[model samples]
Target: MKKISKVFFITLFLVVIAVALGVAFPEKFETITGNIKSFVATSFGWYYMLLLSALVILAIFFAVSPYGRIRLGKDHERPDFSTASWVAMLFSAGMGIGLVFYGAAEPLFHYMSNAPLAEEGSNKAFKQGLSYAYFHWGLHVWAMYGVTALSLAFFQFRKDEPGLISSTLKPLFGDKMNGPLGVLIDVLAVFATVFGVATSLGFGAVQINGGLSHLFGFDVGFTSQFIIISIVTILFLISAWSGLSKGIKYLSNANMVLAVILLIVVLVVGPTLLILNMFTETFGLYFQHIIQMSFRTAPLEGDNRGWLDSWTIFYWAWWISWAPFVGMFIARISRGRTIRQFITGVLILPTLIVSIWFAAFGTTAGNVQNSGVDLTQYATELVLFNMFDQLPLSIVLSIVAILLIGSFFITSADSATFVLGMQSTNGSLEPPNTVKVVWGIAQSAVALILLYVGGLAAIQNTIIIAALPFSFVMILMVIALFRALNKEIR
Candidate 1:
């Protein structure tokens, strides 16, 4: 009985146009997007850093202030899912394949190649590298998602508005949200979600191919990545057809179990003492330097500035790009919780889990490098598996990692399809299966096109570009959210 709205056609048209351009003129598409990406990073890098820091502050204030008492829905409405399931689902969707893709790779990259401040390959670099990884994947990123989700949940559940991004701004804009401006806002959200999720799907496909190549000596290239995406697309489509409770919920729970098993294995076999020490020290370091790191945009021309643009700026943009999809999905699962409960769970707990995860995998990879093995020599996708090859039960560890990545990939793609369907169908709770299927295929097609055009560079370039306009949209959301909350409590 559900009907697709105009937003569906408009967004789909935009996506088709983009995919066609990429397919027909791959080089030109890559060059143009890369130029724009560079301009954004160079020109507005400070804006991103400042905005993300402010959002982190706002998130903390909402959690601890009296506003914390406000429930997302009516006071008597209880959460539909239990605490554990809620946490599992959000964590799986929020950081999923990125954690596995970068767990071992990022920290090692910093120590050997970049290291924000420290000299490459030094003891200081080794220690500082893990701290940088923590910074990139920590509270600042979550604050973006937290603020977006809070606004959506507040308006949609609390104020009985349509579950659309523009709906959150109704207080300031009034019925104008019912017109073209609202359509533009919704269209932007859908566009950002499509690109953001497609980029992650590309990562999943590339990493899966890397794992297969590392294990079975399969060739690594676009062709292999194509096959991987093809197989996974079918799997996630089947899961999508199964609906949220049956497909996504089960997959999310299974992801946590598999991820934990992999973590324990790495901790037991790789470098337990170093991991424990590194985690304790890096946890303190990350909090201690959190303020400085939040606003650290290197102005002077050098490697530090390049590192900031490449890693920090890119991550901020990537998180913003994902805000629409992850935020709405979180809001959908997060009714009946207090503002404090939602913020704490969304911002704090996952940060801790990921910090530990990075500590275990990163420190092990670093230790292996220190022991005379250069993990940097391997491709980013192959780094985790190669790092495992240096440890005990290497084959078992590699197999488990690939499985975990596969499950996380499926969970993320499945969740994105549901979110996209909801966004396109006027915020319906149960979007039609046909709409979901169209989105599933569309997401995969974007991933494939991006891979075909410029691989990882193209993905990062498109993410930075797609996220910029939405960053402004998020600012409006925060202003609208605060206005609504103040009026309610008054």
Candidate 2:
């Protein structure tokens, strides 16, 4: 305790207590978190949208301006990983399970209802649904990741500061970056990360278990979910111990390959032309309505505005919760790259892949519904597997999906622990193996506890509630990055 930072100990202590309370008193905890989630979304949703939009605009300005020429590290530094591997790691870590989880469900939910601003059950409504999918998983979210990475990378690699959230704020806080406020910032980051990662792991574990049940007629309950968490925890810990070069890098590379294989299989096996046409149509519709979507809010109709809070606002908060962990991991691997390159790589490629991914999977699912499949009968947890049933060899494909989510689960948790270890240890580039393992365990423990307590919704609502404060931290981060960049390049 003496050797370690206050940020690590205090954050971990608080997380354990919260998880213990949640486990010891599950119903009360769920009620409290659900209320908090609603309160935050109802009251401060504009903040989430405004800040996220600012990040998207900020990234674009930074990329197109002459400042784009600036490298994240030293002047002569070169990229650490090949482009393909780098993009792979970026998508695998940044989006993780959430992307695949929401691919179909989100769009279908939107399609089931008319947009507050669009016609229902018409072509406009269809476009609105697909557009909502792209919007939720679009450039704005990546802007959060890109800008955070830029600040941390620029400060740590170029300016020689500790690679912590507080370090990026030195331009504003000066010596206070090393003071109590700094500790608080790091503590908030750790707190949010713990719950955020757990929420994701909880989601993946439940979904994977559902797939297992669907594929092999196995039981789906706490027992199976706990085993999934335990297996993933151990696997990711070993990968975390193995470090970035061998375990994470190789897993990320393989993740991309597997993702592509599954994608091609889906495209070929599903409605190929429909998928392609949907991609083209949705991509255009999303862009045309991008400005409207970015600033969209409904204050008049109670139900209309309430809908936005549930879907759009919740998504914004979710991405903000995730940005820090993903930002740090991307920054760690993205040494020796230019600001333009890094921002574009972080922003464009993943968003494109997501667009294509949704088009392939989501379009197929929606088309199947149009053919009188009654997909709405399936529960949300079972929706993806049910979507696969529309194509050939669903059992085989379901197994592949389970494999994909399982690997993605391990890879995401592994990368997050690597970053968390660094944050807790004064942002060491090479955090100790022991520290990495412990952080890995803490992450898994939170996930397992949440799953045991109330399954997916409990963890989901809790993470959204946790992100409210951290969203402010990211807003500060954007300001800090702008100040740091202005000073460095000038």
Top-scoring candidate (TM-score): 1
**How many clashes in each candidate?**
0, 0
Query: Lowest lDDT 10-mer window, candidate 1?
Result: 295-304
- Candidate 1 at residue 235, lDDT? 96
Output the number of the lDDT-best candidate.
1
Task: Write one digit per residue (lDDT tens) for candidate 2, span 26-132.
Answer: 89988888888888888888788788888899999989998899998899999999998899898899887887777777777677665656665566666678878
State the lDDT of candidate 1 residue by residue for 23-83, as single tens digits: 9999999999999999999999999999999999999999999899999999898888999
Query: Cα RMSD for candidate 2?
Result: 1.6
lDDT of 1: 0.92
lDDT of candidates 1 onward, in order: 0.92, 0.85
What are the runs in model 2 whose C-alpha is more than 4 Å off?
1-3, 113-121
